[model samples]
Structure formats: C-alpha cells, structure tokens
Target: MSNVIFTSSATAKNGRDGHVKSDDGLIDLKLVNPANNQVAKGSNPEQLFAAAYSACFDGALNLVASQQHKKIDSETNAEVSFCKDPEDDGFKIAVTLNIEIQGVNPEDAQQLAEDAHQACPYSKATRGNIDVKLNPKAV
Candidate 1:
C-alpha cells in the first residue's frame, strides 16, 4: 500500500451466526445465515459485500465520467451470490452489477460502466477471483 489513504477494520465473532462490530462502532450487529431459515436480525456477509461493492462501483462510475469530461447520473446495484463451487466442492461468490445511467445513451452508459469497472478498486480486487457480470442501462 503506497501512502495509505485510510484503513477500516472490523471484528467478527463466530462464523455465520455471531456478532460483528466495527472499530468505529458504527456497525454492531448480529449475523445470521439466510439459508438457515432463521429470521435475520442483522445481516450476512453477502449483504455487506453487496453494500460495499455497490457504493464503490457507483463512485467509480462518477469518477470515470468526470475524467471523460461527461456528467452522468448513475446508480449501481450489486448482487452478490454465494454458491457451491463445482471445481473444489467448496463455496464461491459471484457478483452482478446492474448499473443505470441517466442522460446518456445505452451504448455510452455501457461504455461508462465498463470503464468504471476497470477503475473500481473492488472490481480490481475481485478480478479473476470471482465471476462478475455487468449490466448497464440508460434510463
């Protein structure tokens, strides 16, 4: 890490059915696996990842548009899925980012989304490690 911008940390107790709290005390919640048929009192890892990825991708979209000297209104929704890995008999995750960009044509919106994906930190981190699908639409 060059010239560290900022770092955030959190602690998780127990695997899927425990508690998690952030160092800033902003996130303190119970964890529950939605697949276990339990009422979710807090949230699962997938939800957290989705939240982070969506926000990051949206920011990346704006940044890319700004660099191109274009103004665009964009929304990014990340769908993270936990699935069984057929290759390893383990579990893996995948992501689908549905992006909506206003004030641009469909092709341009998609180009913006693709450019954003190339710029997003989350997308860079998950590249080649997980399957990511991008769906961009103009609205």
Candidate 2:
C-alpha cells in the first residue's frame, strides 16, 4: 500500500443549502440544493464531488497513457446525478463520465478510459457503491 501523500479537510454548515470551505481556504463556496443542478447557481456537494472525481480520473488517464507509451490529449467531465435509493428513503448518486480525447481513435480512447477507470481513486471508491457510466468520444 502507498503512504498518504496529501490530506484535505472541509466543513459544511448545512447539509444541502449551506456553506462549505476547505481548511486550506483554496475552496470557499456556497452550497446549493440539488433540486435543479443549475451550474450558474451556487454549487452543491454533488458538483464538488463530480469535479474532484473528474480531475482524478483525468490524471489517471494521463498516467495510463504515459505508462503504456501512448500519447493522449483529452478532456474529461463527470456528471453526477442525485437520486433516491431503492433500498431506503435516503438518497444515492449516479455518475456518467464523458471523455473527449484528441488525436486518438474511438477504440483507443475507449481503452484508455477503461484503464483509467480501473486505476482512478474515485472509480475505486464508487465501484460497488454507485452506478458509473463511461463514455468516450474521440475528436
């Protein structure tokens, strides 16, 4: 196992429609409710989670490409949806990762995405916990 190289902490006042800020002060934003998922409005936990996951997955993709001696230039976006869980009245989340890769064919892009998902920390955490869909669109 690898040792922890970094750590981050954040606190939220209200569950959905409050405020959250990291200890480092780098991220300070108001949390909004997920009723509409409006990008222009204040962000919610789902959006923050999506941002972190996408960045991590993109880094993993780049690392995979380097490890495989393959060149890849890509943009990845994660769309997270909040839904009610079937098991209970509580809520759950689903994810769809849309990857746009430049200078690669569709097959190669898909392979790279799959490899990244296998290696990404976010994917590993959500593997059995939630639904994640991977879509690779090459350009």
Candidate 3:
C-alpha cells in the first residue's frame, strides 16, 4: 500500500435530480433528471465517471510510458453504461476503454495499455466490481 497523499470531497444534493458541487466550487453543476430511464436534463453520474476514468487512464499511461523512458502522446476513451440489473434488483455499470498510444509498436502499446490499467486508480477501484473491457487501438 502507498502512503496517503490527498483526499477529495464533493457533495450532491437532491440525489440525481438537483445539483452537485465540489468543495472548491470548481465542479458545480446541476444533476440530470432521468425520465423513462434516460437523461432528460443536465449531466449524470455515468458521464462524470466516464470522463474521470478516461482522463485518469490516459494520465496513468503517460506516467507508465515516462517511467519506461519513453514519450507518448495518447488518447484513452472510456464509455460507461449504467443499467438496471434484474437479478441484483439494482443498477450496474459497464465500461469500455480504448487506448491509443503514439510512437510505439502495436505490441508495446498493448503492453502499456495493460500496464496502465493495473496502475490506474479508477481501474483498480472498479476491478471485480463492474464489467470493464480494455481495447488498445494503438498504431
């Protein structure tokens, strides 16, 4: 385990139909309202999670590449789907990640993509809890 570095705090009001704001007020936004199992207004949790995970994964990839003394400009995209599960009688999430790392061989890029998933905090946190598919589209 690593030493504690920093912690973040954010608050959400009125559940999924009101507002959410970070403690620093940098991420203040209205929550989305779901009608007929679809978003009717504003942003939703899945969107937020997707954005965070994609950016975090890219950062982790860059970090790992740099640690290997290599430079890469890459894009990692995360597609998150939130759906209701009949068996669990609750909501569940599925994620698909496509990572493209530049300036590397395809095999090396795939290796980096796999390594990045292991190093990414979001990936680590969500492991075994959700369905996640990682596809490296490196060229």
Candidate 4:
C-alpha cells in the first residue's frame, strides 16, 4: 500500500511574522509586532487551532458516518475557545461542534460524533484533553 504524506515547514521572522511552506510553496504570516499576537499579518495560534479542529472533526465525522452506513448531508462547523490555565500557566482549548447532517437521526449523529471525537488527529495530539460537545441539527 502506498501512503500519502503531507509536509509543511514554517519559519518565524521578527518573533512572530513567518512564512509557511507547504506542498504549494511559501505563504507569509506576519505578526502585528507589539500587538501581543502570534500572527502578525495572517492568523494567530488560536485561529490556526480552530481551523484544524474544525476540519479534522468534520473529516472524522465523515469517516464514521460512512462506516456506519448513516446517510448525511450538510456541513460541520466548530468553534474553539482558547484560554489560559490559572494553575499551570498553560493553555486549554474547548471545542464545540455544530454538525448539520441531514437524513441522519439524532442518535446516529451522537454516536458518530463520539467516534469522531476519539478519531480526530487534532484531538489526539493536543497536550490538554480537548473537550468536545456535539450539537446535531434535525435532519
């Protein structure tokens, strides 16, 4: 079996501004200098995390649904909140999944959501336990 590998490289300049090189090429992200933000011109860590979480959860849900023979339409959306831990001086993230899966029952959606939460790579990789709540819309 052939495996497809994805690689991305990023370099930070002037503290926060950096360029990320992917399969396509270089993309720039410059911080606002004294803005106390990690992303100068593009987006900060929180934004990036949100994007990843949303996409990953969606992909995982798709896989679960397909495996379960659950038919679904519509899309998946996630909102991630990043906050500092008062005791550890670290950060934590909470993700809320808003899933629109037409033609699928709420019970099936809940099961799939749980499976997706366990399967998503982003959920696996985070240092702190990622909290996920699923909101399934009526089909």
TM-score of each: 0.96, 0.92, 0.90, 0.72
| 12 Cα displacement, candidate 2 (Å) | 1.0
Candidates' lDDT values, in order?
0.93, 0.91, 0.88, 0.68
lDDT of 3 by residue, 1-139 (tens): 6797997888999987879999999899888755433636688788889999999999999999999988889998899997788877998889999888889988889889988999999999999989889899766
Q: Model 4, range 20-127, lDDT digits (tens) per residue? A: 433444445544422465434565555565767788878888888888887776577877777677769997767777877777777877777778777887767752
Please write out the lDDT profile of model 2 over residues 27-103, one tens digit for every residue: 88987785855554688888999999999999999999899888889899999999999899899999999999887
Candidate 1 regions exceeding 4 Å error are none
Report model 1's TM-score to 2 decimal places: 0.96
Instruction: Provide the lowest-lDDT 10-residue window in model 2.
Output: 34-43
Among all candidates shown, the one with the greatest TM-score: 1
Q: Least lDDT summed over 10 consecutive residues: which range in candidate 1?
A: 33-42
- Candidate 4 residue pairs in clash (backbone atoms < 3 Å): 30-40, 30-41, 31-40, 32-40
Worst 10 residues of 3 by lDDT: 32-41
* TM-score of predicted structure 2: 0.92
- Sorting all predicted structures by lDDT, with the top scorer first, yields 1, 2, 3, 4
Candidate 4 has an lDDT of 0.68
Count of backbone collisions within predicted model 2? 0
Q: What is the lDDT of residue 31 in candidate 3?
A: 84
